[model samples]
Target: MLKGIPKIISPELMKVLLEMGHGDEIVLADGNFPAASCASRLIRCDGHGIIELLDAILKFFPLDTYSENPVSLMQVVEGDPATPTIWKDYRSAIKKYDQDFTSFEMVERFAFYERSKKAFAIVATGESALYANILLKKGVVVE
Candidate 1:
């Protein structure tokens, strides 16, 4: 096992992260996301929540500082009646890692699925929160 790497990060996930370059994006998919059908490279992270995975990933993966919105989320459908309180948690976690992160770029549900198809990889998690899926853009490792 790696000394500093988070145990939650599987080898396959680590490889995908390493292969990604600046501007590449990765998605932390929610339980209901069609990961198998949309992902170019799918990393199964069953039994995990997006929040924990987000924290672990941000520890190693740098956010794209050049992008106006380095983060994106699946926008809730109108009149869906599903209040995604989880977004508040996501905002807090993102701010903890990226001070410059202001807000999430809300993508239409269908657009989010299309974007997932082009992502470098998608980490499928067991999170059951509504609209919990998050996309993160990779940035240069300056340190």
Candidate 2:
């Protein structure tokens, strides 16, 4: 055990966070996401929800201050009739760490998968909510 590290963060997840540099992005894929096919590097976080992982990751991960939007989400398809209430929860959790955080870049479903494929790594979570996928860009940690 390490002091200050969240118990929810696994060794593989921690190592991926350490390996990432500024500008690299990580995807926190929802349960329905095709993470195995999309990820260049995949970190299995089975049985954990994205919200808990998001809060825990935000403790050590810095959002790109240089980018206007350091976060991205999968956009709901047209006429889907599914209202994603989880987005509100995402905003709340992100704001807890980044006060200046405004909104997420909404990527069309297929575009999101394409973008995720190019990410430095993807953490596949067991979040059951629809459209719960989120992507976070890494930033420099200033002293």
lDDT of each: 0.93, 0.95
Model 1: lDDT of residue 82 = 94
Model 2 stretches with alpha carbons more than 4 Å out: none
lDDT of 1 by residue, 1-143 (tens): 87989999999988988899999999999999999999878999999999999988888899999999999999999889999998998899888988888989999999999999999999999999989999999999998
State the lDDT of candidate 2 residue by residue for 1-143, as single tens digits: 89999989999999999999999999999999999999989999999999999999998899999998899999999989888999999999999999999989999999999999999999999999999999999999996
Model 1 misplacement above 4 A: none
Clash count, predicted structure 1: 0
lDDT of 1 at 112: 96
| The candidate that achieves the highest lDDT relative to the unseen native structure | 2
How many backbone clashes does every candidate have? 0, 0
